[model samples]
Target chain A: MDDILLMLPGPTTVHPRVLNAMSQAVVNHRSKRYGEILTETNELMSKMFQTENQSYLITGSGTAVMEAGISNVLNAGEKVLNVVGGKFGERFKKIADAHGIKTQELAVEWGTAVTPEQIKEALDADESIKAVSVVHNETSTGVAAPIKEIGKVMKNYDALYIVDTVSSLCGDEVDVDKYNIDVCVTGSQKCIAAPPGMAAITYSDDAWAACENVDSHTFYLDMKAYRKSGNKDPAETPYTPSVSLTYAMNEALKMIDEEGLDKRVARHHKAANATVAAAKALGLELFADEKVSSATVTALKIPEGLTDSDFRGTIRDEFGVELAGGQDHLKGNVFRIGHMGNISYKELFQTFAAMGIYLERNGIVEDGAAGVSSLVKSYL
Target chain B: MDDILLMLPGPTTVHPRVLNAMSQAVVNHRSKRYGEILTETNELMSKMFQTENQSYLITGSGTAVMEAGISNVLNAGEKVLNVVGGKFGERFKKIADAHGIKTQELAVEWGTAVTPEQIKEALDADESIKAVSVVHNETSTGVAAPIKEIGKVMKNYDALYIVDTVSSLCGDEVDVDKYNIDVCVTGSQKCIAAPPGMAAITYSDDAWAACENVDSHTFYLDMKAYRKSGNKDPAETPYTPSVSLTYAMNEALKMIDEEGLDKRVARHHKAANATVAAAKALGLELFADEKVSSATVTALKIPEGLTDSDFRGTIRDEFGVELAGGQDHLKGNVFRIGHMGNISYKELFQTFAAMGIYLERNGIVEDGAAGVSSLVKSYL
Candidate 1:
């Protein structure tokens, strides 16, 4: 198969070093050596989150830990305020509902973020709300919420704060402690650049305390079990973890450490800024609001006289660049270009180059080189 | 690190091809190509299961699917007969308890299999039982239940039959259809020789009907969502799958197809027989009853004077052969040798050679070569 540039929100382009790590031999999960690896991986994950709380690695996808974050801290019949701006934001409400927990929807525009004032008002309006759930970066619409500002507002309230940083943790700025995030979740396949099937979650002392009152309805995702097992001498997960994926994650995190998180985050920001500039140069409008645009992925509106499949299909089949189509309500109207994880200017240049050709071929833009020129200017 | 032989019951030694498959670049889980891979993988899994019922792959450990098997088809307050003979068998009851599902425990001796007559009697007494949960191969005790006979008994009852074949599925005789299994779950890292983090489950028509009546408490492992996504044109998983792990599983399943399931089962049986005979030659007793011993793993009683750590530790640190020690109450009294998934006569001979040296060093056996001689004789 030809090498295709993965420009999707997640399952992002992984570095060869990370991918090679996945080929290492499997180890016994209960062994002391394996436990040491788990300990190191968890510590690195905690450092990435910038939180004092220990991170617990899970063997499933990001959604698994998303459910774990909610189910572990809240009980059935408890009210939680769910900030629904995009697909993932709405998922918190759905998960709460699945566990019989009551949710008060604080719906926002799909491409816009919820303001701190809105959250404060919602919490002030209902004293019964036990928690406030938000998505730090909405992958669906390419919008990033102002979590630090919201954390200041949450300081005045007693509701636990839970955030999903599945796509933005390492790519963007995420200070879990500064944000007062009671429970934070991220997937390995996103900004971590590891393979899918592994996720990590961090829980604050407040969240652990709340868990005492909640009758957790899950077994595989029970945070208490994870905590008990994680507290062992060498540190371990409650169950058998994805050993190969853990190896990949360890390598990815090591890469992040070597590159420096600050530099890595800056590179991601540069990629996002360049993508936005390229879109503007190509006479394309972004799907998300400019003020709240994400640093990990950028969503662009489908150009006039072009279909979603025709546009992305030509780019993938002809140019070997795979871009993600907008999901759910935004399907066929927008496309997303993911610029997270080991993505550098070379991959970004290639992506915009293919996109420029597509726009020129479709007569949406007058010049084919416009997007690449914009990216080059931004990088320089 | 030296190449250590993984002789654990579940996370068996993985083949190089399967490991190499894990290094492939990850693809979009929602793409048509990925869906086709999912389709092929599910088909191969179904074939391995020997069931017409479609199999759904889960991106978690075997324990996750074990929980899914219970929480999806059985509701809170419903009764289930849990046949507990070993650690894994007891896990079903724990999962049911976590979901508020009532469980009637049918406790059997640790090293003995539950007879079909006992199940028939239990079902006859409990008309309210909605399901019967059993572990086909008990890794903790190295016992394989008579699932075929149990299936015949289940035919006379209205309760759904759920079986866990995590360590035994591809390595042992598991005719899901002939066994009349309503639900069967297996892990990827065991007999499949794939990496950890993926599991597959099969559900019958009756199980689906029961799922409709039950309010699934889980969102990640919800069978309804999996069924809906799996019924799509190319077939897909509800959530983002472990993409790299799926690739590895595809290669592992392809390897199984090449070897032929019958030949694989016979090889596993032969390995198990050789290990048992070797243990007898070394004057060590088998932990489980010889009649019900597992084909995938063999549990042997630790020699009277040799500690579990001393015995397995020497083999691991000196000889680089990793073996599993007993769990819970059996700790330090027994040790298990896993002979599943890509294990050959070469690996077996090496294992016995290490065992012989350890026995001689510990003064447990007069002749150090007794075990290897027995293994050679069995193979000849």
Candidate 2:
């Protein structure tokens, strides 16, 4: 069998160089050598986030950030508005609610995107909301929510505007400072092309103030403590940072900067376009509206007689391609094709070709030509 | 300057093989290939831990396990008794206290051990204490506490016995399954001779049950959740496991098991004795009582007119021997020589010779003869 391609939203196919970085034995997190690595890495991460405010390098998955965001900022009965559109969006509410924070949720349809208008409506309706949180790119629905639009609306409100850029940060243009995004958090595995472990977070003074005012219940992710420790020296993390991932991300971020964030995002856009085009040529419906569809992932409605898991399993087991099945409520109906991180058009073509072959072998399609042709035509 | 030897408690000098293992580029975490690695790793880690309890790998440092240990088992107001002697002991208390667990601390002097009698007194004094915690080898003062004695004493009581074996496990023998120890935890960077990001922990059914009953505040390090997630399938984790550290640990554990656990501990003991022998031959004073001194890190009092940091730093800067200076209340007063993890006899002698060179350079010794001679005689 051929090597499998990961087309999932996260824990995405890592660049070989990134994995090579993880393989090195762990280093002393406190050594001057590690300190230099941490110091320089923080500087580079600041450049990537386009923020002057200090940041933290956390050692957990993207969802860990949602927990940290709430545990750091919100106290019990403190009001926070969570935008609910996809699975990740609901995660914001779940985490906040679990923390006993009073939460107001702006709900959207499963396949639809949450708009700035929706965010405005939610905020205007709730004067008690201390923070407005939303996903920049909802991986589950394959929709890039209007972060800039929401940011514009949120600028008028006193509430801090926090965004989950986990699937979007390096996959697209997220000028964190320009957006006035108080808290912008992302994971390592997606657009950075590193493996899962670390979550990179940049926060504004207002966000820090909120986190600080709320006394710590959060351990392992006490952002304020991390800020205090890293402040002494950016090389010093409050807890044991994942040194290997820090090393891998150091390299991955460099690769991103060398390629230029613009070109990287453009590549992601091209791959998503090719994926959508190939799906269209195969006569499959897109789960998300094109206007709001994510440039990093494409959620497709499972074709007739095909279940989401079955389609993904065949892609993995037979064609050596891996696609993400829709999660939670949308399960069994849609499968997603991820195009972010170190991925390229060339890889997308291979993924689509694999998909086509799997469909043909499973008697789900008459021939493999249509899907592969469309992906090639997308490049042409 | 020569390539410095790291004689600090941890992160000890990493093995080149382990470093090379970590340099392998990222692999998709959810891939069958990586899953195979986890499956093998899970089995190997279980063996290293001397447990049938499945391995639940976290991406953070050893303190991560302390936080996870408490958060998994302690609810708000649940009581804990900590046998505090050194840094790691205090660390365990801080972690528990941070979680709002009611704690009774049995504070031993800085350079002394925590006896089972004192632990029982603390336990007898506080019936509300659900867990009695101790650091097996206090990294701070080179004191090896009596976990076995404490475990034996605690057998008469109902509270779970949780031991922090971070600096001692693998390098020192820990009969985790033998001592009615409910929770036994260690770090990879210590005696395990692996990288720093992972923590290895074992739990008895009693401790697992306690974790289940507690209303834990954490999402990331909740041991019950980790156990449940791993129990879903033999090869699963609740969150993104550190694949790179997992790989390095897999290799490190194989090395330890091959060397034989008893022999590995014996090797460490011999090396430690050699370091102490060399220190004594040079007319240096050992900080801890000889009886309870750790077989990993040996703390020594700085000679008159020679401050600890200056002495250790000179060794690191000139001779490439990285000995550790004291922390907290003991700062600048003592230095430690670590015989933990991937270090050796030649390495030990080299460090001793450096110390002698420094002493001679400082006019304390006539020449480097004492350092070289003492270490050589010990080896002979």
lDDT of 2 by residue, B1-380 (tens): 11556788987777777766665544566566677777777677767667766655666778888888766787878888887888888888888877888887888998899888887777787788899888889878998987777778988998998888888988876777777788887788889888677886778888888877887677777676677756554466666776667778778787887888888888899888888888887778999988999999999989899876678778887887778888888888888888898777888878888888889889876655665576677668
Docking class of 1: high
Rate residue A370 of model 1 by lDDT.
93
Candidate 2 residues A145-261, lDDT tens each? 888877889889989988899989888778888888998888888888787778888889888888778867767778877787787742688766777788888888888989998
Query: Please, what are the lDDT tens digits per residue for candidate 1 over residues B28-75?
Result: 888888899899999999999999989999999999999999899998
For candidate 2, give the lDDT: 0.80
TM-score of chain A of each: 0.99, 0.96
Worst 10 residues of 2 chain B by lDDT: B229-238
| Per-residue lDDT of candidate 1, residues A11-126 (tens digit) | 88788898887788888989898889889999999999999889989999889999999999989999999999999998999999999999999999999999999999898888
Highest-scoring model, TM-score: 1
Best-matching candidate per DockQ:
1
